[model samples]
Target: MSDYKAFRVELKDKIAHVAINRPDKFNAMNADFWTEIVDIFRWVDETDEVRVVVLSGVGKHFSAGIDLGMLAAGTHKYGKDVGRNAELQRRVILKLQGSINAVDNCRKPVLAAIQGYCLGGGIDLITACDMRYATVDAQLSIREVDMGLAADIGTLQRLPRIIGDGLARELAYTARTINGEEARSIGLVNRTYADHDALQAGVLEIAQEIAGKSPIAVRGTKRMLDYMRDHSIDDGLEYIATWNAAMLQSEDLRIAMTAFMNKQKPEFAD
Candidate 1:
């Protein structure tokens, strides 16, 4: 494992586990932490070695959201630091947005294993993932409203696509916590585990299942699904038609079809 203050990343057998490591601070995102997150996504995509990602946080809570100190720092606008500092504040927000985008943009599937308090910026971080699972004791919320702001990252956009506008609006407007069972019922979470250990095991099970699939098919599916999320059905049809123009001719497709016809398992080559 590499040394990182904000997070820890380890890769093995086509799976990557990313743990938010600022436990003392409830895995809070302070500027550098978000920047590191963006870098991690870029690195994973570049290496192409990781087929799936399991995201979790160290300690009691998945995350308590953005660090309070960083939020307070924005109030520095009232002081004599209005020149460069204002620009710095905007930059910080942009970087945080970029961090969320990194996760969403990764072609590999991502599974979030949440526990404890996953609030505010934590909600933003997670809405970008492909799937979410939680411990029964977990509490989740879009806490930004409680902070006098809206969820400015990927959550406000991608979340509605997953859970629909009604639930997303309710969570953002009320700033209320949702437990794992409720989260699962409402589609905010896929399932609930009895505890952290169980949650971790479940996360690994799902990640490995995804890692076992053909990378080309999985990546193409994720891309197509993301595209279809915002596009009209006609648009999606045309988009995929263009996509499959060449992909349908890949050797893997031929092998898969032949194997299926012969009642044999596929042998996809990288």
Candidate 2:
């Protein structure tokens, strides 16, 4: 993967390891961040060589959310003209939301490994991932409320379905920070390690395991899970049946069954 101003990307053994690289600024989202993230996920979706992705941060923190300076500059472009300002703000919000949604919409499963502070937009980023793991000392917060604005990106929408309405509402209302343990307890993160080193190692192992699977089956499963989140049980069941009708015919199925009989690992093609 080419170098990005706001991220570090490394592709290995069908797994893409992507880390927010702006450590000096706590990896804060700036102008480059919004566009680069969208580009990265779009590339992931188009690359058949990649089967899974691991997202994390470099240095001390995951992210401190949007850079206050960047936020100010972007918003300041529209003056106090109520009509034009509102329309411009709406467009910017939609663009930001679309970038975050790309992570959720990617066909490959995304696992986020968070450490240090994951606040505001950072929380929005992780909630979009398929699974989240964090360092035990990490601090997470839904901090937009503290800034006098509701989270307009995705935390308000996706987080409620993640940790339930009561807990999600409490976080949004209070803007209180939660440690990794509390995050795990609330089902925000799947697991927590003692430190950043352990967090990265643990997440990489899981990513490797997922990357080893049949890409077709893995992608199909991710698609179904996303679909089921919005539909009823009956609808989900019918959708999966129709999905399998086409996907079950893949050569990977034969490779897997034959591997089982021979007690060998299955080698699947993209």
Candidate 3:
């Protein structure tokens, strides 16, 4: 709803298209990106009309990772006390983590449509999404090792879970770039498209299909999947049982059943 400096958001047919707007610098992440993303995703979470989100960049490349200038400026501020400086830097890291967590924690599914360069912090960003699709030539890397620092963002934690620990380690240790085909082979991205236009269209088609489903059912499904990640099989079953006890009573269920009997499409209210 509000204007954002780092992203351009458009909502239509219950799908939010959240695109990184800084194309000139290859859609690099700057100071505004870290802050505005939190605001944008929070809006996406609170807005009930939004059923799904398609995240992409408005450029030839997805992102070149954190802007080097911003990274340098952040390190320039230090106090005389070494412990105090460490505390300050720790807080900064936590703030950045919260930005990426916004996407991971959103109730609605966020699908990333990556193209070209998705390096360093870009890896952190996409790893947090519910699903990822990319152009065949999109180059993805865990680049912090080359920058003289380990990745402190969500990548190290989430990537291993997405692609398994062994391959995740190889990428992090070597800082090697992987194209879309290899990414799919490793299960990093769900699929690959021939080019940027096809990637956008394909991802948006998936988003639109998801948008047409019952919002309550979709949100419940996402909640269950997220819950299962840290919970045991027994716990997940119990949780879903409790969840459906209430959700199953919604009018959407009755509408869906009636539509099935009559051979008509069901329309759910926002």
What is the C-alpha local distance difference test score of each model? 0.86, 0.94, 0.95
Instruction: Note each model's CA RMSD in angstroms.
Output: 2.3, 0.9, 0.8
Residue pairs clashing, model 2: none
TM-score of each: 0.91, 0.98, 0.98
Q: Give the residue spans of candidate 1 off by over 4 A.
A: 77-88, 258-267
lDDT of 2: 0.94
Can you give the lDDT of residue 251 in candidate 2? 92
Model 3, 1-270: lDDT tens per residue?
Answer: 988898999999899999999999888899999999999999999999999999999989999998899988987799699999999999999999999999999999999999999999999999999999999999999999999999998999999999999999999999999999999999999999999999999999999989988899999999999998899999999999999999999999998889999999889988
Give candidate 2's TM-score: 0.98
Those runs of model 3 whose alpha carbons end farther than 4 Å from true positions after fitting are none
- Candidate 1 structure lDDT: 0.86
User: Over the stretch 1-270, how does candidate 1's per-residue lDDT look in tens digits?
Assistant: 456779999998789899999998989888678778878888778776788999999999999988989878777665566777778767867877888889989988989999999998898888899999999889998888887877787778877888899998998899889999999998989999999999999899989777876778888889999898779999999998999897888887888788889998775654
